[model samples]
Target: MPENPTTEPTPGLENLLHETRSFPPDPRFAEQANAQAGLYDEAKADRLAFWERQARELVSWRTPFTETLDWSGAPVARWFADGTLNAAYNAVDRHVEAGHGDRVALHFEGEPGDTRTVTYADLQREVSRAANALAALGVTTGDRVVIYLPMLVESVVAMLACARLGAAHSVVFGGFSADALRSRIADAGATLVITADGGYRRGAPSALKPAVDEALEPRNGAEPTTVAHVLVVRRTGQDVAWTEGRDVWWHEALEAADVQHDPVWVEAEHPLFILYTSGTTGKPKGILHTTGGYLTQTAYTHRNVFDLKAETDVYWCTADIGWVTGHSYVVYGPLLNGATQVIYEGTPDSPHQGRWWEIVEKYKVSILYTAPTAIRTFMKWGEEIPDRFDLSSLRVLGSVGESINPEAWMWYRRVIGGGTAPIVDTWWQTETGAIMVSPLPGVTAAKPGSAQVPLPGIAAEVVDDEAHPVPDGGGGYLVLSEPWPSMLRGIWGDLERFKDTYWSRFPGIYFAGDGAKKDEDGDIWLLGRVDDVMNVSGHRLSTTEIESALVSHEYVAEAAVVGAADDTTGQAVVAFVILIGEFADRAADDAGADAVQTALRNHVARQIGAIAKPRKILVVPELPKTRSGKIMRRLLRDVAENRAVGDATTLADSSVMTLIASGLAKPSTSSED
Candidate 1:
């Protein structure tokens, strides 16, 4: 018989995971939201019309848009082009005006057990006063203001106030260095800088005023700064150095100003915020999200994806306001829908490891959204800790930041949700302002690691290098084929870089910079970043998939994989892993550590094939991560290749990589040795 050429394996194609495990939504929730399943069909009929309807229905517009989208210029898309809307009014005022003024908007819990519940009415007054104060500080429409603060109500107020006054605000993460904050302020050409005296962290009052002062200092004997004023909030009552005329206290300023500023409507395309994201090279790219479209999608997604019941559900998204998740889910999304949410201002393990669970129990939080790294950390701490608390309030769980491993997903569902709550593993980025691809908790029978599909009105696909669609059970690049309302307008002041970074990859299609796979049922499973996809010889393998495979092992709790320089293959897989429970004790002894490393390598070989097995594995107490719980794989790659790590300053614990490097110096007993 002649050979069947079509059935043969391709030379350069890599082996892919055929993950078939699935979890259906809770029957009660599904029954309650039968109409949500119909949105897919409605959006399929006409995506533009669906978005137009969503925009009109979700937000209160001062001037309605005639056109839904104008994409003639390709990459530069304008959604709700002719619309005019006040983002702050849509987020706060409308809820209060509709007789929900007494509703609790933010249930703020401070690190020192201090609590404050701000209602819609209270929020409206605070925002109005803030807007008046900002205007008094010489801020006006289109002016840039930099907000660098902790997870306080003041941060939310400052953001909304900027929106109310039609000023574009840039929020720098409180954990960031002065250099990082300064670079963003310079990039945005911000005139006003808002910061707190300090914030509480790990049961200690950390001073932030010093960083702010240093950031404003003259560099290389240059001119002082472009900043006109520095507004300070007294959070911890910590004394700070006064800049005389340039500095003003929040209380004094707001007290002196009139609290009757009206919200101003801005054009739909007018920039709402300039959020800077770290790029692989050069300065961080300031992602620009505009008004009407961004707000509409954020509000709509928050309502549907979480199945938020504004009056009942106590929602919480564990993200800092410095990030996009905080902007959309934590603030704009929930407030726009009149939803009550818990906002905490401390690390999850501060004072107690059960802090998050305590808050969930205390607030009766029905919807819990958080990052997968935090989940893995919770898993590492053991289920017994959470077992001590009453987490029965949790009805729906969410995972973001990175593609969640199946093991972590199962742990999150079983341990946290008690196996009943649905998990909505979302896939989006800073570039896409809101959740782009996520399972509707009430509609999807979600697979453990897969995002399942794009939401209604979002067009996404897994395509090969030639821009052709990849077959099911194949791996390819993930791209958004259609522009959505919440898509970023451009990289602020660097339209060319934005075009080159996102659009130039696939011409018209928005290359998401992530590798992905389509399952046999055509559900999309996100692989990590395209840069994270390593080439072994000529075959491509996803670092996230391998890391998932590693974490699926009984002993491993969390894993980070990096592609290191290799002579035999183009790049070799190197892994740094943290063990928990019994594995941690076993890894303490030299011989047991050797045996465990061998077992993990074999485990990965069995689970994902030998090609995906790590060439080297280091059993470490911790992995390098940022304050936001993102693993610093770039530093790991540097360590793996035996090169000097560029910067360790951004790490939550700068000593972590040093510890890992020291651990790697020990002998290897594996067959790969």
Candidate 2:
């Protein structure tokens, strides 16, 4: 936690890539910005006082907190320990009470071209009714509920209803397998499940109830699950095997219940929700987030980071309800700020490739936030697709999920924002609960592909393996030197594991699993996860940098880099790239594919030094990605090392691995010398 640990140089990650392009905030944008340059100085003067001010100004606390933070428990921090609040009330009811009931809370756009608009009053009534229905089914304070539904309006209602009753809700992605769902259900000891019969995907009705039924079914020699009821939403109206005693229709339950329910006021440290993140071990880690502090930070960051004008701006974050970005930006953050937002239900390319732009144009979305993977996919589709649509309403753009390459960032700024909007590339994990490192959009001069710096109240630094802070223009591990409000309380049911995983790495500092580098200006640049760093000829190179180098090429649209075992170099870099739509035909033949791969290899060598060049480059049609749009580099490594593909059930399309593996058999460009 020392501001300056030892300054001794160490052999850590090699920062070989440099980005010099910078874009400052527009004068007009900065004039009306919510976060001014003075905010940083205020936070630096008194960090705790700054947070206490934010907590008071942003959130609607039932009982004001006296104590700001209690870090006496070491790794486990108690923020705003004496405060009391209700997340659902702050999100829904308070806006209704403030005469904003007529304001649009959600602009729901179904993938099948169906649409519905819900106001704050409408949301309050629905959430209250859902809470009543849940209470009738024996769900109350301290109870756990598992939600396994698609991106439906009811999904948001379900999460809010759980929060309203002080019951923790754990949402599992609808794309997850039955085994994955069952593991989360068992770990949370959930008593009820909320799901739809099915949801629309790619113009087809995909059954979801079957997965829920399979997950809840009796296992051989396993203990019975705690689930007492199954609440089903009729999204697709797909036929499902009925369990007469345990199942209840969503609409019927809400219709039968009263539309009036009281919000449960819980203490600051009360458990709000438990979201599961993938762990090194087979089991998923249930990240426990408490009530008051989590709401405080999420609301604060959401308002300032995007320079939100809640009354005028129509915000949209293209993340599903299952991910943490959705938990923060899509649900809690925007609603807490009384901002109207859009929520889509299907893939970006269902009926056509222009589906997302069409929605944005229809909604006049001003603030847009999405992942880099999505931007790269749009790049592969070409810029002409978005050029057909009117995106003049977009003002501020944002990126999340992972580190973005500079080319994708520039494309997004040019094509989507019309080269005028500032992009806020954010860095945070599921455990962090909200955005930690991000540009203020209006105050800071934005740097392409860099998170830039920690937010006003956060303390983050790049440190070497010896816990010494790396000097400016050095690369090392990213660590949080101080506790933040929204930091995860602990791994659910396993305090020791939480201590061992995050705390033990630096004794007291929370070591983020990702590696990072500091520029000459001391700005932080994320270098993906430490496990993805490749060791070639004793140089520890970042996969993100190599992938960025490949993507910087004009022909390349997207790239994924992995480290495969090499007898001579210990680990060699292998890259998979997708060409732009116009150039796809150039790589259609074996000879043409080899030519394109060779060009990309040379491009990387020139972008960084020759030591950072990819050992092998394969022109792939697509890379394996998860439902949340993160590339599965582990599976890519499996294909690169010539090993049998591992469990690919978690991928958005399991067949993607098969295609990538088969592509590996074709002629590839490689070098051994």
Candidate 3:
């Protein structure tokens, strides 16, 4: 990808570049961050000293660190290497010691309308008990534990317990297929597995333990798993086939265990958790984050980025425990800060479309961090649903997972924020462990679609193919010039892959795999993934740019654009769009669909240029997304290329592909004019 493409602006595209509204930092919240005054300057002066200061200030260390950072090894850097700390103690025991034991730690809302509130003291006791049970099961220091459970409190307890025992936990998303789970477990060589009998989804019980069973079974010439034991949390009490020697119930184990186990402090560089993220090659990379550095950055970023008011704010990060967002925000960050938060155990739309708003109103949630996918879904559902409820409690809104379109960003600010709150569009990944680029609510004047700038103390830039920094307003690959505290230590047991995937791309700089650009004010805008930038003729048009143009139209709620294989143009843009509330009903009629589709094609032509217009427009009810709400664009690429669809195991609803394929059989409302 080249930075600042020299191509002239496509004619008549000016209207699409609407002037974005600027939001200034809130006066009251601006001073709330303890490190706000001299943070960025101090970091710039000495990055090592800044991180060391954050490590010491954020948590109680059992042994003080002598070294701040050791980047002498180049891509494999170490931070606070000599320091000793316990993640569970920081997240739980220390908060209890501060006499904030009675403060609510988790406000668990299950999908079936059940709720449980756990205090810090209660959490500490539970974690201690679970730690003891793990010890009894022979889970020791440096051992890997695979946690495959839902958004239950037990899942949180199990993870903290693993931390308590100095065991690295790898949490596979509950929606992952047995093969996916098996591969992660096999790669990590996990000894113990924690799962639930079943979980609530779409207002009913869904079996999960069966997946674990299948994963453990050696089918299709696969070897038997390394898992020695499976600990089950009786979430829905659904009957599971018993494996006498391998399985034990959570209630049974905890019943026999004492709640007085002490947490052991480990070296700062000791592995905290192994989070497996998918690579382009279809292999799962276990992103490794350590104790002191990962925690320090996670806590620091969460506190300042969200402008968290620990005592006053009711925070909710709508991410599953499987991904990094949940690990950083829902578990470590919020818990370390002793912040009260809502943790839901189900999808946003199970019983009804307004479940999230109901929870927000019910809990008076002040800070809401969610993905753009959910926001767009809400847009599809219409604003009247949220209008029925009071949403004045929300003060800050956030976006994660992917780059939010300007249209979606504005709608999120205006509708969900009640036109008062500021939106923080965060950019980070599983490898980064915490937020890297994002607008600080009370600091920057935000651009709707842009991540704006890297967070203070983080050094990031958009660079051209030769690793040279691109000029302001230029488009290029995004890279981190300096090593940060929260960067992944290695790809578990595959240091070479870690280095090759991230470091090899840009020599010493960390390649983020995304395309980016800076505006006239030097604010950064993320163009989707580098692979997502399609070559149409000799012009490289980003899928994000085309999708943004499609979504800018009032009738389109969400849009996904893929470049299909073409003989003439090399790759032709094929778009899938979801219509807004009444538009769906209207678009269902063939005549209306053709008219609207033609208008949208012209809309994109006018927005960018005829070169960027889609060759076909398919209006569908839903796009195939993962359970984590990420659009599986690879599948869309397969659809566009007319290839046999690859594995649909990761999709939230794999059956949607059938409908889409069937829909594709009909004459498309396409315009090649």
Candidate 4:
């Protein structure tokens, strides 16, 4: 690779950060990997043919697809349109029929020390029973069901059961408020709701049924909900007020239903599921994904990207089933690949700080996938906690959800991966349905904090405002040049909004709504969301870049940067950071806090440039993050701009904002620029 280039500022975005470190694939792992260099060449030779081959090989289609793609619909593509398949059958029943019935499918671990081991055959029976039960409740094909349950094996069963009946399932995160749940239920026009009495969190039972009851109640003379029945799982055995005829016990219904129901075969274009995008303020856009294409891509990515050896490897993705990551990776992808995975139902720190590593050690997990926020939290808790466990079973590490900082990437590689395991930092969205851009662990040399090149059969590029491709060492908006098999069909019931939001930005291309830059090596590095980009004195700076620089400092553990309103500069950089465990005590006093803040500001200036340095730095004990482990920078912007903190109900811990706001009331460590 050429040396990092020094160029003038570009029109789209100013390229600032430079990374030279790269780790090539280990020869031994590469030799036996599922994906090889030829994979890319094969895709390049004929993209549609490559995807067709993948569909034919990875998925078990009830009726084979003769057609690969039909772009006659433009933005809303029809992939494998004429094919027929059952997602639940492909994920569960097919594996059982192939004599893998005894293979473990799920290893469920509850926060309160409860455990359940389920096999492929067991999953098939459970799904069949649930499908029968749902059918008895008048949930037929094309009906929508809302699932608001904790991360339990039952949650997985519910989703697969819905798929088995050809009914679309929309899983709302358990952490969401009643209003959020009601909005989604109303939008989807769901007929049935599946929830739990409560689930254990932080070593205690957290009631979930109340939220469901609240959501079902008509508020402000609103029309009665379309919901006909509520299926409640007795997780915590808590007393829940029930509407006698409307609410039914999950176990009782399943026990009465026969376990011989057949899977419903539907066209490839049948809606598989609808997942609403998180962190949205008003009405949420429901991203609709179809069966054949979604299953094909997710299965292919799961097998190759993680170098998954289904028979030998134990994979675990630490995501709740409510989010897209949980839907795609935790439930669909891994299960479709016939891979055994661990599913945990609690926060990382419940019971103890070492709960996650303990589960990893117990399960002998070979592949671990998680978000950078969790990794940074583990960093704050100190490495000694993880060091206490035996992590040698871990072979590959994966990062998702958002752009990871280079420092967090390094820490994850060194401490968690045991220095040699490959890390695949995947980049994709709910709209994409599956992984799009990610380094093939066995083919490309890994670069810290960079997603690298697009995956085989995926066409992505960094382009300027004119939709022209940026140079190798330039920064611009990221766009997908061609439609992929797993691309979302459209936002449910809102075709025009879908076109305006994603397609209107770049004609004939899918704008990812993210800013990105290419290194001199032509590797792509995500620069956070374009909405988070700051304009400082006419220079556009990525909050991700500045946060990366801050985390690069030895004393800083995690950081969130926001652009505050400025009279002269238009926008000024303001940062809130959490210190490492050892350095956390230093921020107790004003002098130490000032010294630490100044040092981070100076480090950012040296790392990127003076223009990227933060104007003010606040040493926060914790950053507000959502349940999915994404930092809530909008809340920080409120604090930075001296406005009242916005609605923090969605945060994992609303008290975090209060602590940060109180800390800001004290003396701030402003840079003397």
**RMSD of candidates 1 onward, in order:** 3.1, 2.5, 1.9, 2.8
State every prediction's TM-score relative to the real structure: 0.96, 0.97, 0.97, 0.97
Deviation from native of the Cα of residue 138 in model 4, angstroms: 0.7
The prediction achieving the highest lDDT against the true structure is: 4
Score each candidate by Cα lDDT.
0.87, 0.89, 0.88, 0.89
Q: In candidate 3, which residue ranges exceed 4 Å CA deviation?
A: 2-18, 31-37, 219-221, 664-673
Clashing pairs in 2: none
- The TM-score between candidate 4 and the true structure equals 0.97
Q: Write the per-residue lDDT of candidate 3 for residues 1-673, one digit (tens) a residue.
A: 4343434222222334455667777778676644364667788898778888888989789999999889998787899899899999999999889899999999999999999999999999999999999999999999999999999899899999999989999999999988899999999999999999999999889999999999998677777678899999998989999899999999999989998989988999999999999887858999999998999999999888888889899999999999999999999999998899999988887788899999999999999999999998998888888888889999989999998988899899899998878888999999999999998776787788889888878999988778888776567789999999999999999999988899998898999999877776788888789888777776777788788888988889899988888999888889999888777777777898888888888988888888888898888778999999999999988877778888888899999888787654233557577
Please provide the root mean square deviation of candidate 1 (C-alpha atoms, Å): 3.1
Model 2 alpha-carbon miss at residue 643, Å? 1.2
Q: Candidate 4: where are CA atoms >4 Å away?
A: 1-20, 279-281, 664-672
The sequence of per-residue lDDT tens digits that candidate 1 reaches over residues 1-673 is: 0022122222212333344357776678888762378899999999999999999999999999999999998798999889899999998999888999999999999999999999999999999999999898899999999999999999999999999999999999998999998888888999999999999999999988888899999898655578999999999999899989999999898888776778988999998999999988999999999998999999999998888889889999999999999999998999999999999999999889999999998999999999999999998889999999898988888988999888889899999999888999999999999998889977889888889799989999988777888777666788999999999999999889989999897889999988787777788888788778887766677788788888888899889999988999888888888887787788777898888888998888877777777888887788899988899899988888888876988888998878777654333467653
Worst 10-residue lDDT window for candidate 4 reads 1-10
Clash counts for all predictions: 0, 0, 2, 0
Model 1 compared with the native: what TM-score? 0.96
